[model samples]
Target: MTDAILRMRGITKTFPGVNALADVDLTVRRGEIHAICGENGAGKSTLMKVLSGVYPHGSYEGEIHFGGEPCRFTGIHDSERHGIVIIHQELALCPQLSIAENIFLGNERAGRGGGADASGRARHGRGRGGLGRLLPGLRLVDWNRTNHEAARLLERVGLPENPVTPIADLGVGKQQLVEIAKALSKRVRLLILDEPTAALNDEDSAHLLDLVRGLRDEGITSLIISHKLNEVLAIADSVSILRDGRMIETLDPSAGTVTEDRIIAGMVGRDLEHRFPPHEPRIGEEVLRIEDWTVHSPARHDRAVVSGAALRLRRGEIVGLAGLMGAGRTELAMSVFGRSYGTGISGRLYKDGKPIEARSVREAIRHGIAYATEDRKRYGLNLIEDVKRNVSAAGLDRLARRGWVNGHEEYRVAEEYRTGLNVKAPSVLSETGKLSGGNQQKVVLAKWIFTDPDVLILDEPTRGIDVGAKYEIYSIINRLADEGKAILLISSELPELLGMCDRIYTMAAGRITAEVPRAEATQERLMSHMTKEQEQVG
Candidate 1:
């Protein structure tokens, strides 16, 4: 029997009016990959936070045992001292900093005069240290030595050796690897990864999973929290299900009894016949059309993100744009929605076969177009604002009279959608940022739906949301289509696209490579188009 590396008993966490976790118990064995599965807001993150000391000792009721010793970690630093590290779903690395600097940020070296410097030689890099004395140790950084260590750590996490590169320069997958490297920098006995591959492409996700298995071989234990069932089955040796912040069961993966359905059943307390509802096509006339659309990347010159892309969305149809990361599906949607993403965009759009000019977001909305961005926190919704403000933001002009905002009108508008969309929030005045990711996404959706758009472009609409929330969003999409709204769905999950869309268009290198109808689309065909393979010469 493998030795248990970490154990939590009767872990109960409570917030103002909600029980985040209740009697949750999890046992992670040494050198094994243990996966935690649950729906969104099921308390997966809260449970991890408890274990990693994010909630601290007295803040929550729990008993944590790490490596056979009871622990009461006051903060993240305290947990790190005991070789416990967690890489959250949202990476904690500074995008502006170099890979090396991000890895050694709080643990940086200082000059002889106690000034911050990265030129020092290497010394005690293990565990966390106070920021005050960090600067005085600059002489110990040793760029060459730090780079060598960083390179080795990156290799361990299946990343390329480029420590000097800025964190922003790397792709999401690479940045995730850097997060893992940072965690591994400390003498991590147990590593906790929350949605590590959520943003990664298939190739990158596969590589990260492989690295997890590699880490297990190296005698390092891991706790993986992910929504990707196939990925959990691929890498996990043991699987634990959490529901409503409580542990349901822990099953051995090698027993051959554990299946995706079983995991879902354990998670939701009922059998889910299908992960997605069956789709029936009710095709209609084209409501939106794009001709010879092209967009240059804002960050890169001489690069076209969307190159002569042409597509059509008919009323009562959901057209899915499927592609690998960097394929420009989001860019194309953003540029079409009012040139919100790129520069030098040239696209001729037609509404009901009549040319329509949309130079900005307002113009796009005025022309009955609404776009829900993938990155809800950064682009879709203002986190600091309340649900009422966020939901009524895009359509504030409708609620305004003579340049004086009508508070009651806005509240009524927000209340209508809040109830209509089944948004779970304390009140309309609740801050959008305080809501769970699923709720936040719903607010963004509510905002767009309020626009009464003829054509709605949903970019990764269900990304990072829970399965329950996904079902709601899916149902909303179907209803919108049934109501004769033209919907353009861009998603990374092929299954989602296949399940919800009437037709799926696969993109490769900023161009539509294949258009597969719901009747014909398959994972095999879609993946073929998504992979970056050179086009054959005639």
Candidate 2:
């Protein structure tokens, strides 16, 4: 008997102007955590899509063998029937559905029984619309059995949420567990996670990795696609590297050869001597300062999202706001940037020691202030629009002539930033959505940078991009600071802040708890200050 549970030979996949995968060969031994590592657009996700039948059988040239049996999966359902399930990073859960309903969704089990919900109508698996919209072969869900099975699966994944809990109520980490629980409900044999923990905080990431380990121990094989090389090094039994749509090499960490450095060398074809570019800040007079800034929640009228937040940014200085999730970092930044978020806002803003008021986004831009949102997909860029439109969106007035936008000037400005930022796209006409995460991030930066802002507030500037892309973004930030632009950087990654910021401020319970200089900062100290309110209350 052979130990291999999965084997794909000569997998060649192509898109309209792109060869996603080229004669790639991948093998997986039974009960092992195999990681796939690559930079953005290296075809890692495309390869997984092929294996999981997102590209279908006739769409790609490949031979797949699972459990020594030749497989021809035509769609996601076909792969699922054979115990292969993939969970994408964005998550497919419907926020309004209950845990049990989402777990049993699509893979619905029918019964010859009445399943009337609270309104006395036939419960249709908590799907939108009505009961008539159930999946084609599935009718009449047995709610009792569904809830029981969901509870059992939840226990297996170590999620203690009630089966009836709405998916929106749980955090991203718990939502991930529910996804795995759904996979287990299908009796999954080979599980694939595509950038599973990219959105999760550190504690949640640790829990998810531990759960993957536990699942591996139970004889389940896992394939993880991640940009986080450190996490891959910690959990992967074997790692496969992909570059330029070709298989480079697979390394076994058990033999002590697979390291972050080794993996980076393979992914980018160079030794990344430094993850962050060194910088010497040219500190100058205070560019912007906020005194007694407080913002109440819009939904909850009485709740103070940002309470008495006081911070200052100096010319050519990068200041970091470090906090745990919901600690008011984003809220503070948004409210200060012309009340983009929060309500009942009270603040005093000064620029270059002169008082200024920006009551709207337009006014903020007029005052030479720009806010780059963390959720780039949602608020930053119009994904359907091309690069030129997004780049000139914030500062359209500059290209406007007699109430009409000069397309020629807009294109010129966008092309300049595109070349300067090294945005890897065909041209300024490519749709923003089609580009990779790193390039999309550059577009977001280009949008704000076009405004020619003197103060830039970048929230989670490098959240989901690869390390190489992150280095590029860091260099951009350094260049901005060198140009005498005061930056307020907000990030959850402590190492990133410690490396890039000249000073870091800790916030907890919506209040600025401590301001620590980079020379005196450590992760432990930052964490302690971040949880100060919780510690005091407990």
lDDT of 2: 0.90
Q: Per-residue lDDT of 220-298 in model 2, one digit per residue for the tens? A: 9999999888899999999999999999999999898677889999999899898789999999999899988989999
Q: 187, model 2: CA deviation in Å?
A: 1.0
Lowest lDDT block of 10, candidate 1: 110-119
Q: For each candidate, what TM-score against the reference?
A: 0.93, 0.94
Candidate 1: stretches off by over 4 Å = 109-140, 532-538
**Largest lDDT belongs to which candidate?**
2
Provide the overall lDDT of each model, using Cα atoms, as 2-decimal numbers.
Answer: 0.85, 0.90
In TM-score terms, candidate 2 sits at 0.94
Candidate 2: residue 313 lDDT (0-100): 91
The segments of candidate 2 whose C-alpha lies over 4 angstroms from its true place after superposition are: 115-139, 534-538
